[model samples]
Target: MPDNDSIDPTEVARPSSSRRDPEWLRARLDDWLPTVTGSPATITRLEIPSANGMSSETIVLDAAWEDTDHRLVVRVAPTPDSDPVFPTYDLDRQFRLIEHVASTTDVPLPTLYWSEPDPRPLGAPFFLMGRVDGVIPPDVMPYTFGSWLTEVSDDDRRTVAGTTIETLAMIHSAPVPEELLDLPGPGETPLRAHVRRLREFYAWASQGRAGSPLIERGFSWVDEHLPVESDPVLTWGDARIGNIIYQDLSPVAILDWEMAAHGPRELDVAWLIFLHRFFQDLAEMAGLPGLPEFLRRDDVADAYARSSGHEPRDLDFYITYAALIHAVVMYRIQSRAIHFGQAEEPVDTDDMILHRATLEAMLAGAYWAGVR
Candidate 1:
């Protein structure tokens, strides 16, 4: 979840663009579904979720097809006028990536239905998948603040963490298709290439706005401490508990693959760890204990090793890199907010990053000393 330091959690964060009309979408679906399924389809209900993501727009729709009801999710690209977070929205790539992972691995994934590359139907490219019924950790108040995850026993939380790691291991073990390789050119290491991409994204995001000094320093620190390259694998780019759908304390399906890429296993592992820490730190800041013991760095590393037979190495660098990546994302989100008039431009652009202090601590090599 991107940190919104000033925005109230009770207020849902969405782009300032005009809301998509549910009735218009229902009419479009009514026309489009029959062409894809080869059967007449009637959309009974079409709703824009209240908690739609700041990036892609998720549509929850119920329809009658072949005399049976179907509940499905449609992930539509942000309209060009919405000032999308990422520069590009490749729905086709995301759709194929999910399809590939579902076919090649046992990683829990939603049942995929079809991909619509044409933008005419929804005003943007989108893909359809069966909606899995489960509880997702809320990003608004944050599960760490208080949610089902917090109410569960420590043992249940442990089960959630352990099983989630196993699912990540399964994803990493999937065969990397040739199309997924967007690897570095001849002279670059995968880690370096990854950092380079981050730099590029930051450059694009910071244009026409104040740049964050903390983010610049983070890039310098990464350049100074880049680790020896690890073998790249299929990495679930946004690997975190918040992106998962859980049933009875177990992950039933993994959601959100826009960031899926070819990267080191540590990229995924450290991201999972650092994201929890991000939320935990927020919880503690609010005088809440949070799940301090959940998703501990060392515990996650050990569990990944046990599950994958490959020891995670250089996590300090990787974890810091993870924080830096998240900082850049948060910065971009805040920039969008400012553009949409939801936030003011802070005197110090670093203020855009809610975890600026955390990133600084990581860069100073003092963050881990304070953690167990």
Candidate 2:
């Protein structure tokens, strides 16, 4: 094994943007290969760039062994004292569920390699997976709307959008593993559970700071409009365009299953739409087609309905809930960044400002929509 005595867990850190390590992850691969294959392998390279403002450090690994080369991803858990977003996450369960979902449905995810559930070797729970090749669009859709419009023709963009909807449909269509997920017993609704969880999260955030009163109001709003509970689906905890890897304007692999759980179908759909705010830069905010012009809000929902055999007529309700969820997460992160000494003060700018002038617009929207 490599020299563990010299390795400092703090040294391998993630930036506020992309929290991934490109260095020394090979050491982890070296340690894991022996356990899986009964022989050590040579690691050539590892590269894990930080993702946009998301927690957790993700790295990529390239290894050579037995005269063959392999590419994979090593998702290292953040130090407990450093990233306190979610104290405990079941990465091994996540790995197994990904494999299960991949086998049962058409949802695309990275192939699995191994999962290190214990923190002994790497200092925290981490997992390795086959590296997928694709392009993740910049937060604001780096390509100009017109260029994105012209380069990938409208028809192709629609196909991609339709594919996204269909992929989600497949996920919603999959049968939930009753034994695996410790969901409440039959006839026991989960709305109260969701509410209790969110309340606890808000309480955690409000510990030493003045949290947005809007959160409590949002909770009330959700309580008032709770949908009639239906069968649960595999809710990709952080499902959004940014989490998807696209190839040739089409989604190829879905990433980030840490928060995967059995929840309302609208939760996934809401998150997918609310996270759209992250992709709107200034020009796009001013009506320029920031994303592919082919993806209308209705088109996605309609496609999902047609493919999943379920109609989502109350999309507005879900959208508002999505906005509230983003708002809560952003507020919590502001507190976390302050606690970590990364930011001098806590400020909620309605999903992190893309431009300076629209602070009021964003906040007002988040406050009313998220909390309403």
Candidate 3:
């Protein structure tokens, strides 16, 4: 595995268990270049970021095309035998969704060139898009580091933070194309849809094993307080700092859209705040200037409400919902690694520590929700 800080972005692939090595990926690119572009292409170097968690094998490839050097990103899904918990949606849909936003809004994002849904190409679904240059610090990778304030000047960090929030707002505000998204039937509430889908995720995780008490508690709270909310907004499921690329202390592009869907406007806000909380203590950290000094959760909710017609109330319920969703997601990832054989086992001693800490947080969150 190449060190993210030291690696030549052109020469390495993310060494996660799911993705292929640089050699294998290079060979594939060499084989496909002529078919797609009608010209020979050579992948001079391949490097993958290590942050994507069961979402996709995202990589950056530096290649030469007709004597011109270019950087391209490939988003590839895991192998089928390595069954995933949530049925993966089409990358073309994600590409078109983001592309649609770019066409309509001022949201900065990587341009999409092509998307191949059939696994016949790489033994899994893959898509190619223009690469944006930036460095994602490890501290910014997990939401828990939200408090490890950036060394960059406040103005620059705010620019990065503002770009993310603004882009999300743009995505939330953009008129969703019905044909581009596989939405639920007409008149369905997005909140209900999320709850139902999450329940299904838990069911899959607990198929042969006993359910986690933490999950049961969280699920009960979520079911009882189901928002029954409806809003015409595009919700990016895994909206977090890690997904956005920062260049010169500003976000150049918003990266992952694999879990995007149509949902209540608050869902996106709650998800963003939840993600921020995982990294920073909102009460202590000043998220983005020109915004309130309070937790970004409040700022995000207020910002979205002010921009859109709908406002987010019962913030606790939504926050709890976010925690539950992430808890379940993390647990499922561990379950996949531990039982499903989809992920490579961790040799690091801290793996178990992190898992325990995650569960503790989940359970504590569930406990608090019940108390509330």
Top-scoring candidate (lDDT)? 1
Candidate 1 global Cα RMSD: 2.2
lDDT by residue (1-372, candidate 1, tens digit) is 223355344333665564688889888888999998799888888889866257888899888889999899999988778888888879888889999999999999999999999999989999999999989887778789999999999999999999899988999999986585568768987778888889999999999878999999999999999888679998889999989999987789999998887789999999999989988877776767889999999999999999999999999999999999999998998888888787778899998887777898999998987764
Per-residue alpha-carbon lDDT of candidate 3 for residues 253-275, written as tens digits (9 for 90 to 100): 88788777777666777777765
Candidate 1 segments whose C-alpha is farther than 4 A from its true place: 1-12, 16-18
> Can you write out model 2's per-residue Cα lDDT over 24-69, one digit (the tens) per residue?
4556567877777566688887776655325677776787777778
Residue 202 of model 3, lDDT score:
80
Instruction: Record all residue pairs in model 2 with backbone atoms less than 3 Å apart, i.e. clashing.
Output: 18-50, 18-51, 19-50
Q: Estimate each model's TM-score.
A: 0.96, 0.81, 0.79
lDDT of each: 0.87, 0.62, 0.63
Q: Rank candidates by TM-score, best first.
A: 1, 2, 3
As a whole number from 0 to 100, the lDDT of residue 66 in candidate 2 is: 70
List residue ranges in candidate 2 displaced over 4 A.
Answer: 1-24, 140-151, 185-188, 281-289, 292-294, 346-372
**Candidate scoring better on lDDT of 2 and 3:** 3
Least well predicted 10-residue stretch by lDDT in candidate 3? 1-10
